[model samples]
Target: MNHNLLLDSIAKHIHLDEEETALFLSFIQPKKVRKKQYLLLEGEVNRFGMFVTSGCLRSYNLDENGFQYIQQFAPEGWWMGDMYSLITQEPGHLYIDALFDSELLLISKTNLERLYKEVPKFNYYFRILAEKSLVSYQTRAMENLRLTAKERYEKFCLRYPTLVDCLSQKQVAAYIGVTPEFLSKMLHSEPELKP
Candidate 1:
């Protein structure tokens, strides 16, 4: 399997020597997931952190009425996991699934801890990633509270430009926190807003 993408992502944050790179590679377990396949389900403890090598994955939760609310999308070159469950080893509330047939590199919690001790620099890399994730979540939360559905859709389009045309309208509606019909009306009313 091609590891170049993952290695390149790591290189951006930490310079790993040949031996170090090999060690890191040794910790990864490759996985392939078909579209709509569940990588994780509600109440399951997440044992691995996944790095998307190809295609897309999404994490979402369903409400009592069975409406889905998407939390995040991990496209190629992105990392994803239920941080709460991964760190605490407790059940997670979200469900994670492949949005398209995908390839991933998974590092189990045990291996991740070993890497932190063995390479130490990985601590810095993960800290940066966590900080950025936190910032993005905070920004999205604030926007949800303040922005209109149309504005949120615009932001979603900007954030996941690659997904705009590829995702189903229902999926887009879920992410933007609007009903499909509402999104449809908004798009039709504002022709320029169509992604």
Candidate 2:
């Protein structure tokens, strides 16, 4: 695995000197997850915040009826975790799983705090991540309310072409808030839906 991918991603946001970078890397624990493996399950406390170095991971929830609703997809360079659980040290409702065999760099909450205190600049990087996450969730909520199924699919295709190709049609339909059957019809109806 390319451990430098995590370092490069951090460097993009903050200036880390050699010693600081080494210290940061020391705090990260590299993990490999198999496809379909659960990194976190509903009701489990999230011990670490994860950075995807390769392959895909997804955060989702299951309804009472056992239907899946995808909250987010984390491809390479993306981060995943339940912030509420990590912050409060409580069990989380979200389920996180590897959609494909994946490599990750994980930092525990304690280590993250130490990194903030030692490096300081990581605070800014995490802040930007949180802000972007907020914007993404807000946009998704708005799109669900305002956009048609086809429009949502179009926007999704534009935003996450990689995911559209990597994920199954049913998974894409769940993310876009449509039944797989309906999404199939919509896709067949439009040539542009082939993302």
Candidate 3:
């Protein structure tokens, strides 16, 4: 499997030697997922952290009324997983699925721990990743409570500029916490939101 992207990601935080890189790569397994395929479902324990090589994936939770509230979108070059379940090894509340046919490199929790031991620098890399993920989640939570729907839409656009043209209006609405009709209306009323 091609791992240039994954290696580049790792290189951003740590310098891995050839041996270290090979050992790290040996621990990960590559998998292909079809569009709309579920990588993880609610009530199932999440065992792997996935790095997207191509396409996109989304994680969402279902409310009591069965409405979906999207938590995140992992496009190419990003990492994603059910963090709570991966850490605690318990059933997760989120459902993770591919938005397009995708390739991923998956590292299981067991193997990840082994990686940390084998390549201690990975601990620092993962710590940085966890901190960034936590901050993003916290910021989104605050934005949901404090920002207007239009402002939230703007934030979504700013955050995922590459995604705007490719994603469906319904998916965009889900991320910005609005109904698809509401999003369409807002876009129509404010031409500036078209971007």
RMSD to the true structure for each prediction, in A, is 0.8, 1.2, 0.9
What lDDT score belongs to each candidate, Candidate 1 first? 0.95, 0.90, 0.93
Lowest lDDT 10-mer window, candidate 1?
1-10
What clash count goes with each model? 0, 0, 0
Better of 2 and 3 by lDDT: 3
On residues 1-195, what C-alpha lDDT tens digit does candidate 2 reach at each position?
577888788788888899998898889898999999999999999999999999999998999988889988999998999888999999999999999999999999999999999888888998998998899889989889999998998898899876788789999998888889998987888877775
Residue 67 CA displacement from its true place in model 3, Å:
0.8
Better of 1 and 3 by TM-score: 1
What candidate 1 gets wrong by more than 4 Å, as runs, is none
Stretches of candidate 2 off by over 4 Å are: none
Candidates ranked, most accurate by lDDT first: 1, 3, 2
Indicate which candidate wins on TM-score. 1
Q: State the lDDT of candidate 3 residue by residue for 66-179, as single tens digits.
A: 878898899999999999999999999999999999999999999998998888989899999999988988998999999999999998889889998899999988888899
Between candidates 2 and 3, which one is better according to TM-score? 3
Per-model TM against the reference: 0.98, 0.95, 0.97
Clashes of 1: 0
